[model samples]
Target: MHRLLAGFVSANLFFSAATAKAADLSLDAAPMFNWTGLYVGVQGGYQWSKDRSTEFFTPTGAATGFSQDFQPDGGFGGVHVGYNYQFDWLVLGIEGDADFGRASDGFTCCGGIFTFDARKNWEASIRGRIGVTPTDRLLLYVTGGAAFTDLKYSWNSIEPLFPGVNANVFKTGWTVGGGGEVAVTDRVTARLEYRYSDFGTTRFEWIDGSYEQHPRFHTARTGVSLKF
Candidate 1:
């Protein structure tokens, strides 16, 4: 009877020690994540845009058609700011940025020729980022959000060989895009992203009984980022 009692006590102690070791091991294997800081960075790349046109009748009995195409491909650069939150292998954040650049095209209708110059004075966005850590030294992520832009439109045309007519217009619209980022160091990260923005459409009326028309645009960019 004493031998059986000793055997039962030994089994119970073995299980108790095994349970305690498993709990300790679980705590050690868990992941630790944190992201509570402010970061700023700059990016630059190229953009492509599509323009559309429309026509209508005025108060007077006259017919007119105005169309313009803007194909501006150039370099753009800007700064960004936001806060980040980390969860194990996942990272979420919101960011805002602004850039200044120019993309231009031309317009023609009703026996007159006009050039449309679309300048991007500033633009911004708020996006969410999701990423994964394949190892301690590398991270890959995808981000997207709402965007906005400020655009200006201008035109020059001939008026019956008497004089030239010039008109300028301004408008604003919303934009959206997605991209990926890679952490190159503790304080620096690189990004390759594509964005699409639409500034809606606007109308330009001139004193020479004529007007110009335009539509929204889409832009894509890529560059690097520095975090601190």
Candidate 2:
């Protein structure tokens, strides 16, 4: 009985020493960034857009030989909110944001008698984000989901040959993009991103004739975020 007790005590001492050594090694390991929190941010960038519209139309709504194309370029800025979960080397999250863009131009097409003005206004999107962390402080990700925006289309008579008409509509579309983010501090991060949005095609009609337009845009943005 005495020998058995002595052996048991020796075994426990060895076990305790092993546990302490393992704990010390764990404490000495490299620290990892915690990305499991809610974040809010603001971003700004440039946007370029292109749209095709019918310039000349047949009296019976048939296609004509002439067409119209317009391209506008400007800057945009906005704010966003998101939540992220990091597991191993992967980070997944969802983010939503909205921006106001300064992109518009006026032109006369078809017969040069009618002038048209197109303005790109407010835009918003909700997207799923998936990324990998090559390092703790940096993330590379791609995002895709639904997008929203509106266009202000206006038409006027430069020579009084046609009546002035205008159309305003809200549009929904699809967007896809990618970005890179870096943690700047314990509670701050910043990112650079690029996205493309397609608003599809639709036709607008007036009292005398009709026209069709297909609109899309590309945006490159930079943002700063605060984590909570």
The candidate that wins on lDDT is 2
Candidate 2 lands at a TM-score of 0.83
Clashes of each: 1, 0
lDDT of 2 by residue, 161-191 (tens): 5678888878999999999999999789999
Q: Pick the candidate with the highest TM-score.
A: 2
Q: What ranges in model 1 sit over 4 Å off?
A: 1-36, 60-66, 108-117, 132-142, 160-170, 208-215
Q: Which segments of model 2 are wrong by more than 4 Å?
A: 1-30, 55-59, 110-112
Worst 10 residues of 1 by lDDT: 162-171
Task: Report lDDT (Cα) of residue 128, candidate 1.
Answer: 68
Q: Name every residue pair that clashes in candidate 1.
A: 147-175
Query: Each prediction's TM-score against the native?
Result: 0.67, 0.83
Query: For residues 124-223, could you state the per-residue lDDT of candidate 1 as single tens digits?
Result: 6767666666654345666666666655555555545544434444445555556666666666767777777665666555444544344455556666
Q: What local lDDT score does residue 30 receive in model 1, on the 0 to 100 scale?
A: 63
